[model samples]
Target: MAVNEIRLSRLLRTSKMDDSENTTSFDDRSEAYSEVSARDCLAEGIIGLLLPTVEQIDERVKSTRISQLELRQHIDTLAEDLRALSEKQQIPYDLDSYVKKLVNAKRRVVLVNSILQNTQERLNRINQSITRENERRTALLEPQVSTPSEGQ
Candidate 1:
């Protein structure tokens, strides 16, 4: 059995030595054992190229999520700071005007996100807001079911 295996390996090696380029071409069936398929090679190349794109997308997503969270936190801090400012009568921020601006800004966010589905989290935020609005509407429709505008 060992002798047979060695003999077969020698024969295969010799066949490979005689046919280099011809063996590499796809049309040759005898070379199938030694050659790689075009599709497999192409897939490997495509995946190699796509790795960076996928990694970039993932990084962008992580950064966007971090920024979004920071923005919301900053908005909360603004509200608190505004309250403190108003108490001191400094009037740096007009609460009514600032709130009105943010409210409309929220609406614009929704509008832009609704039209642009490719904006993933940007769209997700709008969808979440819309869902909350729907929940509020449903609760309002039923006075005692859950009560509209419940606390977070």
Candidate 2:
């Protein structure tokens, strides 16, 4: 059995040598193996490069969500501030309406001023006319009052 095993080992070694000697295009096969290995290495390197970018994109997305939440909170705070300011200033809720109301109030003030000026002018004219009429009446009565001595 030992002799057979030795013979088998010798046979295997000789067969391998024979196969190597008989193989054609050995360089071509080696070149093909090297090309496949190089391609595998390049693929692994490309995947390595892409993995960090994917992770960075994930991080940015998470940060964007946090930023959006902060923006929402800021907006809510601004709205509350606006409400408080409106209450403090006795302003209307809608800005457009408040502006309109102010404009209308100004117009009304202008109109009332004009009316008051007109009424004042009319009163002054009437008072002047009354003064003139009183002076004319006094002039007419002075002669009648003076003639009372002629009858005596």
Candidate 3:
């Protein structure tokens, strides 16, 4: 399990929520991933990063390229995690995991950048929600509500 996790984490490829563990192509995940809700993608990205590795991330990202077998292993692990999440029924945990995976994912453009943009847009949306929420709250608390009974 650990070895598989490490392999998947290293490859950094587009992950699927379906039966694609045996698949060697990113095109399947990319085609369906965009249609996936933001939360699911973010959650998947997080799991991708949390999985461990023996090689230092820097070297994995830059110096040496991963083999097809390794990439397949990575994809397999991710698919497992997605399957687990589906089974466990845990929703978006946090950004830490997502961000961590994204860093590796970015390093994995040849490896795993397809869903990066989609994941990023999700983060942006979450951030925008916070900003908009703050704005809305500030507007509400501005002490500008006039009492209808004041004149009465």
Clashing residue pairs in candidate 3, if any? 8-74, 12-112, 108-111, 108-112
**For model 2, how does the per-residue alpha-carbon lDDT over 73-102 read when each residue is reduced to its tens digit?**
564565566566777775456654554555
Report the C-alpha lDDT of model 1 over 62-85, residue by residue, as the tens digit.
Answer: 666566556656666676676677
List the candidate numbers ranked by TM-score, top first.
1, 2, 3
Q: Could you tell me how far off, in angstroms, the CA of residue 79 lies in candidate 1 after the best superposition? A: 2.0
Model 2, residue 87: distance off in Å is: 5.9
lDDT of each: 0.52, 0.52, 0.46
TM-score of each: 0.44, 0.40, 0.25
**Model 1 segments beyond 4 Å from truth?**
1-36, 87-94, 103-152
Q: List the residue pairs that clash in candidate 2.
A: none
**Candidate number with greatest TM-score:** 1
Pairs in clash, predicted candidate 1: none
